[model samples]
Target: MAHPSSSHSRLFRASLLALPLLLGGAAWAQQPPPAASAAAPAADPGRHMLAEIQVIPRPVGTADDRYKHVDAAIAVIQASGLRYEVHGLGTVVEGPPEKIWPLLQAVHEATLQAGAERTLSIIKVSGGAQAGGPRVEDLVRKFRN
Candidate 1:
């Protein structure tokens, strides 16, 4: 298997660093999501967005591996090009809610594709209708080292 180059790693790190600005800037708010120029803002008027999304895949444990299903669900999140950070209880994602919300469904379905009989998703979203909301850095920058 081919390994990811250092440039790809740097690119991904840059994406993470840039995510907060994207999620909390008037520039992003004024424009529509990449794919949905006209329909997205109408569907979700929030100027910026952040979501804590967690997926639980049932048959959550097996004799062979306790976290197999959970791993599959996480794989989907990692593969998504959107910027995200995985935390203890959930993974936080930042982007236009119109795009993030739809992607949540895909994350939820990933475990089922991995052979889980059932799945559940817990999601919490925060944003503003009149202006951009706080970015992750804005909320927890002090906690970082």
Candidate 2:
């Protein structure tokens, strides 16, 4: 029979040998792959785009009360003077991609800054040519008729 201390020492050595595998190897401490060294091409500021933004904050229950969060988001969109329409599920805004992207970011920040503890923003973007693209009205006018 093996001595108790000898068994314990064997178990300890075994555990030490398993530690690296359990912890995902020593590569965990190694630096990640270097980022792309080349500078990315600059985006064209005049590229036309359409975006739908929906901001949902927590504590959703009552309809009247929940609309305040939606209202807060709309206020930001209104303030930006961008062409937009407030639909049943979300607001659709159209402008240059450069403008619409930043405006979406601002809308999100404004909703949280206004006092929402948590916020979820859903954004859908459609990019098109710099000079022409479908607007919100064009997409929904058929349904309205």
Candidate 3:
């Protein structure tokens, strides 16, 4: 019988050898996007991306306003002029990558500034490189009743 540690080492070596095969898609991603034809209309920057943001604030402080800290963060999103919808878990905001990326940082920082002892913001952003990703409605329309 081979030693368990030796067997595991051999398995690890095998996995390492397979890394390039597993990461072949990553190499494709690094390649430049195909050039757009002159006749194609450019995608609007304001409608190119969607971001889901969830902020959790600690030491909520009171029963009457348990979401006080969270609400403060939300206020920033509401005023940003970007299209957004607040769901049970998070708020989804839509716009360009340039705006959405920095705005995510603002939302996370807003909770801490709202007197939260600690805070966390989970964000998911979706977009494409050259063409542009789907709209919020395009993604969830079929699922809706």
Candidate 4:
């Protein structure tokens, strides 16, 4: 025998509590449809794309005192035929994405083949709207002197 006004207030409070969950569910469900394949690139590549890559390999318990695995990766980069510059931290290569992606993979594999048990690579890509970004030479021009 609850009062009619009291029952209406209880229902209103319950709905207020449920509103957020309902809205959140709707927002989550509104996400764009999935792409046809997982391997698809996120965006279309422009004519010029640049990638800066650094490969570091840990060659467990070696006293050679030289980074042979890193050297192996460098050799792969050199042979990639893409425009590249070797810096103290990483190497920057400018070219089309189609070429740069495989080149990065090859560098990682080459380091492993050179006897590294574990390898870590850092990569940064700039293209599309940033296609006109500075090249490697531009960054190192003042230092070249």
Q: How do the residues 30-142 of candidate 1 rate in per-residue lDDT, one tens digit apiece? A: 67656745543465445678989887778875768887777777787788777788888788988777778887888888878878899889999987765578888888899
Global lDDT of each candidate? 0.80, 0.81, 0.83, 0.81
Q: Kindly list the per-residue Cα lDDT of model 4 for residues 1-145, writing each as its tens digit.
A: 9999999999999998778678777566567877687585654454667788888888722577477888888889899888998888888898877788899899888889989999999999876664455676776789875
True-structure lDDT of candidate 3: 0.83
The residue-by-residue lDDT of candidate 2 on 22-81, one tens digit each, is 888767536586888597546675567899998887642235575666677899999988
Candidate 1 vs. true structure, TM-score? 0.63
- Model 3, span 1-145: residue lDDT tens: 9999999999999988777668785576468888877784544654588899999879653477888888888889998888999998999999887778878988888888878889878889888776567889988999999
lDDT of 3 at 84: 92
For every model shown, what is its TM-score relative to the native structure? 0.63, 0.63, 0.65, 0.61
RMSD versus native structure for model 4: 12.5
Q: After superposition, how far is residue 139 of candidate 3 from its true place, in Å?
A: 0.6
The TM-score ranking, best first, is 3, 2, 1, 4
Candidate 2 vs 3: which has more lDDT:
3
How many backbone clashes can be found in candidate 4? 0
**By summed lDDT, which 10 consecutive residues of candidate 4 come out lowest?**
38-47
